[model samples]
Target: MTASYPHTRLRRTRATAWSRALHRETTLTPADLIWPLFVTEGVQVEQPVAALPGVSRWSVDLIVDRAREAVELGIPVLALFPNTQPDRRSEDGAEARNPDNLMCRAIRAVRDALGDRIGLLTDVALDPYTSHGQDGLIDDAGYVLNDETVEALVGQSLNQAAAGADIIAPSDMMDGRIGAIRAALENTGHSNVQIMSYAAKYASAFYGPFRDAVGSRGLLKGDKKTYQMDPGNTEEALREVAMDLAEGADSVMVKPGLPYLDIVRRVKETFAVPVFAYQVSGEYAMIEHAVAAGAADRDAMVLETLLAFKRAGCSGVLTYHAAHAARLLHG
Candidate 1:
């Protein structure tokens, strides 16, 4: 007689912890995380970002301490964003090229303290340095000029490289900036520096908390629709990735990771390159609030959410929960 039940039972493997572990399709670990830290000025100060909950804007001195902690946690990299003071903001974002500026200084401090133990990544954008909060120079018509921005980004990338930045992530989305930065790196004897372009960065509402953390919240006069990708588009992401790869990006990133996992999956499958995602500040706050409200278990939710990115084929994630999640994994 024919069997009443199916021959294959998927739940059999999931019935035990060991079985589940052996059959797991995706694995997440501390090495898969890249911590994004906010850099501010001064010493002995760590300002908690209200919107981002556990996140903080640390001073250059404090950043080195955090870098030591990150090394202990096994987190492989740190991406830095500066909260440039108002007095330093400029129309042309000239401060970005200053090797002694906040971002550059933080990079040097962390590298000097940690040496080659952890990779240092820096943002090659003008938003944090611009008086008007635009990512690049704009004309009287309020239109962002592309070529001028690319030139500035090249200078920014060189400055970061000089300060020991291992990766130059161009989040500004300016046209041809990746190729420009890549060439500048090679020509200036920084051939070892990597360009991890924000190839598919979307102009999403999910970045509000990040703006606050970086001190660009109230300063932005208008939206970044001119450069950043539209959230409504998908295929455009692949094209953007292709262009950036052609221009010499060592890796490409998809922003606001959870909401855009489909894009992450597509890009990973299409290019087969090292794909990364940014679990932006808003996503971090949402999960934290849910846990605070008793709507989710903190440890379970964080690990599961992180594993989902791995299942979606992301090689690594730039997340706010790096250290906390690393502790859970190690435990």
Candidate 2:
């Protein structure tokens, strides 16, 4: 239809790819991607996670190869998760502090191979090392003990840093652990090690695949509702972010990305820090299965979901799709 002098046309910019690119508000690239890799004990293994297609539990030697690939791809960071052997899982999660544990070994292997070309982010939680599959040690009542857990986390953080981890990420969601870990890091002369707190982590149902990836699903004795935030609240997430920031978090994360992009936006808006999001295991699995079911184009869906995080004000995202997205972006 013909328009009058005062009429406006919104589709002009959307008419062409070049026009759309020039008018775009958010851009996704490999630099904004942080690949999350799972490490299991071995030399040349790539254990497929059946629940999480295209994801695997790589061994130490192969992890070095992953680090080299990340360096080549311009992906600035790689978050490492460990699948502890059955015999190594303990009640106190004491293996978490071992200098030569699976996680520590993976961190060292990567750091030694790639140097500082890519940041090695180690998850500072005990779920992978615990017999009960809880992030913290539980008492007779099966309730997670806060103070004790903080101590264990502090030890875990120090151990990771000692193993040359560039960032110590506390994903446990326990109270007072950030400050304690920071203080411990400084006291141990590892003051430059960054702390990326999983500040607004919600106890959401989207973590099943993650638990499976880390081999913790079956061992989980109870849920983490007492520690991780409830999914029904928003104000509480801000409070959690604020507390973590004030406690000396170098940066903060909002987990289970798509479901909590609101929290990511609010965190970036309010704190004005380098807020990050985790395009977690379940999210990855859903997209993979959707592509398998022919619901959406795989490449398009991956980039769209990642760009949503950038539009919501995230500095970067920890995603399993980092490699695929990087290759697409490069192409």
Candidate 3:
């Protein structure tokens, strides 16, 4: 079988680990990770998210400590999601606008504890604060209203910014919210704050574990098809990314990362902006289950899956595996 092709041996570089490392095309590191932390009420409590094996919902006091650990690991950012008490959940998600709310308080606490040691990203969606869990104000007909939701998102973004949030991430997918939030941030003198819009969030079944983390699954009355994009279409994702960029999004995200890596690649290719991906709750859970079942190696799977994002043209990724992956990379 070894004929004239024997002259071109590809095994030379693959013979040594050092040689392979020197020739690696893409490198994964702690700097590329963004840890998603769930914020709840109380002082030092850490509640495990049942659906997501290694993840937990920590109170503000404990979250400050976690943020410090993330900084020590060279992880640059932490995205905050709140688990509001049932009593605080309202139809209009008015609690989201309160400057002293759980999310805002956590943002301030982390900022004060670590200063600018790490970037603080606060979620601007209302599903965590709403009883109906629609991510926006629901009409009598059960439809998620786009314009009205944008107005509330503006208020939510302003509140987070007032609490010292470094970035206002609009995950609600409501039309025109990015422009409105950008304008609000400017008017409120937060001109330097960044906007990372969840521009191509598809309505996917992979969001179940995420809903459980925010305590929104059981409260959700119906599907969010009206707002989040349909998974069947890819051109629509390009349009959404373009619109968000035009509206002043500093970076754009394609959610449920593994399933939509194609969308990530396409958006990055067409728009040439900073494209981020969310290795969402269910994706984490699936890998965890396989590892637990002895079907896969945890360390190998984590690094491979993360490198997949890099290969697919992601600038950064929001992942629950950030700390673990960072430790592996640093090792």
Candidate 4:
């Protein structure tokens, strides 16, 4: 007689922890994480962001200590964003090109301390430095100018590369900015500096905490919908990714990660390139709030969420929970 039951039982492999590990199709490791650090002006200063509980903006000196911690935790890269002082910010955001600016100082400090031990991914955008809090130069009507913005981004990319940044990540979402930055880098003898384009950043409500952390919340005049992608368009995201790739992005990123996993999976399947996702501030804040409310286990949730990124075909993730998740993975 033939077998009455199915020959293969999928649950059999998941019955034991060891079997589950052995059958795991995706893996999350400390090296796969990129920790985003916010830098402020001053010495030995650590200012907590109220909106993003457990997250703080550290001064350049303190940022080096965090870099050390990240290195010890086995995190591969650090993404730096600066809280430009009000006095320094201008309509044109000229401080962004200042070699002595906070971002550059923090980049140099980390590179001085860690050398090539870790990769530095510096954000190439103007919102942090712009008094008007737009990612690029704007008109009197507040419309973000694409070509002019791309020119500023190129200058910012060259500035960061000169400061020892390994990756110039343009999160500005300006059309043709990636190509402009890439050509500038090559011509300026930074041929090895990788361009990680924020290819599919959508205009979402999830970026509130980030704006607060960067000190741009109060300065922002209107929404960023004029430049950022629409949340309702998946096909548009694919087209954006294609344009960025053709323009010379070494890797591409999808912002506001968890809600955009479908986009991540689609981009990965379509491009088969190094794809990264940013688990944005709102996502991090929600997880923390849940843990505080006793509705979820922090350790379990952090690991599970990060592993989900890996499973969703993300080559890596830029997360605020990177260090904590790394500790759990290490344990």
Candidate 5:
């Protein structure tokens, strides 16, 4: 007799845990995470960011201890951001070139304490150092100038490189900055330093908590619509990725990860490069809020969200929950 309606059982494979596991397409592990940490000036202090629940701005001393914990958890890298003090903020952002600046100091301390046991990535941008909270230098007309900002970025990149930054991450989104930075690194003999370009950074509402963490929320006079990519565009992202790759980016990143998994997938498939994503501040806060409201299981939500990145073809993720998630994975 011919097969009937009940002949095919599609759910048979899912009937057993081993079968389900074998068919799983995505997985999360400790190696697929890069912890993003916030730094402030002081000793032994951990200031909690109000908007980003469970996240803190640590001092260099406390960060060293945190680095040790991350190493123990098998997380391969850590990205650093600084909460630059008001007095240090300037129109020219000259403090960014200071070798003893807070970010550089933290980089040096972590490298000295851990060496090659963990990779240290540093943020190279003027937003934290500028009084106006813009990523680049502003002209008299209040417009951000591309070439001027590239000059400052070169100085900032070399400064971080001198402090032992293993990866120089330029999140500014300024045109031609990647090529300029690559040339500067080669000339400065930091040829081994990797460049993880924020190749498709979007100007989304998802950055509120991150601004608060860096103390730039109230300082930004206007939106960053000119430089950052519009959230409505997709083809522009591929063009940006192509430019960065042509300029010699070691890897590329997609920001605000989950909402743009399509972009992540497209970039990875088109370029066949090491693609990464940033589970940005607002995304982190939203998940935490849902968990707090009893709408979601915290541990399950974290693991599920992280696994989604892998399924979307992200080589790794820069996430606020890296440490806690790493602990869960290790357990």
Candidate 6:
């Protein structure tokens, strides 16, 4: 049977790749990718993260190579996370404020090698440096103290800024830390350093692989529900974003990208500011596992998931698949 169609047929434009490209409302590019790299302590060492397949922790020397690779790939920014040695981990997480710590060394090394070619976004949380594997200072009861944590974070931010970090990313989810960090940065001669707050970070189960990558999974005593947002709440996510923005955050991030795209869209719409999402370690692992099990195509899944962030109004995304996706987009 033949059916009559309307004069404007959407299928006509969708019939060709060129037509689709010309009509594409959203675009993904290497410029929209922020590659996340883990830095370890050694020379020319690359330790593979078992939980996060295809991801590895590179030493300071090798991190320079990775930075060069990112520059060659046209990736504008790199987010650095450190895997502090167990001996360096302490109850006070004081290593986070060390001028010569692993994170500071990597920042200085990359800045010295690459100069201003790329932006360095440094994580300001203390979980990697803490013996208790918490993002902040804890009392005897093990509760993460908000004010004390903010003070430590201010110091951490200043340390990174002194080490030439271009962006200070406070991922601790602590209240009022953004304003404190921003003020500290301004007073300490780092007025240009940006703050990308993990504004609506949730205490989600998807962070297990990340914890392992940072070497904090085994050390974590309890959940971060007391600080990070509850996954079930949406309005609260907006409030978080609002507070961070008001606190002078240059940008805001929604973590575990795919699962919280709704939150990303909401934040972007409500705030009308730059919104970024983290295609976190577990999200990357899920794709890798699916491909290994022959359940999906790796390349297709990576691009599709990344493009979803663009469609959801993300200014850019911090993705483990950044390099691979950039290569695919180049092709």
Candidate 5 per-residue C-alpha lDDT over 1-331 given as tens digits, one digit per residue, 9 for 90 to 100:
7567777777888999999989877878999999999999999999999999999999999888889989999999999999999999999899999999999999989999999999998898899999999999998877898999999999999999999999999999999999999999999999999999999999999999999999888888688999999999999999999999999999999997999999999999999999999999999999999988999998988999999999999999999999989989987
- Candidate 3 TM-score over all chains jointly: 0.98
Q: Output the TM-score of candidate 5.
A: 0.97
Tell me the tens digit of each residue's lDDT in model 1 across 1-331: 7669878978899999999989988999999999999999899889999999888999999999999999999999999999999999998999999999999999999888989999998998999999889999999877888999999999999999998999999999998999999999999999999989999999998999999988888998888999899999999999999999999999999997999999999999999999999999889999999999999998898998999999999999999999999999999
TM-scores of the candidates are: 0.98, 0.98, 0.98, 0.98, 0.97, 0.99
Cα RMSD (Å) between model 6 and the true structure?
0.8
Candidates 2 and 4, the one with greater lDDT: 4
CA RMSD of all predictions: 1.3, 0.9, 0.9, 1.5, 1.6, 0.8
Worst 10 residues of 2 by lDDT: 1-10
For each candidate, what is the lDDT?
Answer: 0.94, 0.93, 0.93, 0.95, 0.94, 0.95
State how far residue 8 of model 3 sits from its true place (Å).
Answer: 2.6
* Segments in model 1 whose C-alpha atoms lie over 4 Å from true places: 1-6
The local lDDT score (0 to 100) that residue 59 gets in candidate 5 is 98
The residue pairs found clashing in candidate 6 are: none
**lDDT by residue (tens digit), candidate 2, 130-195:** 999999989999899999999999999998999999999999999999999999999999999999
- Model 6 TM-score is 0.99
Model 4 / residue 91 / CA error / Å = 0.5
- Which digits, one per residue and each the tens of the lDDT, describe model 6 over residues 47-97? 999999999999999999999999999999999999999999999999999
Candidate 6 — what's its lDDT?
Answer: 0.95
* Candidate 2: residue pairs that collide: none
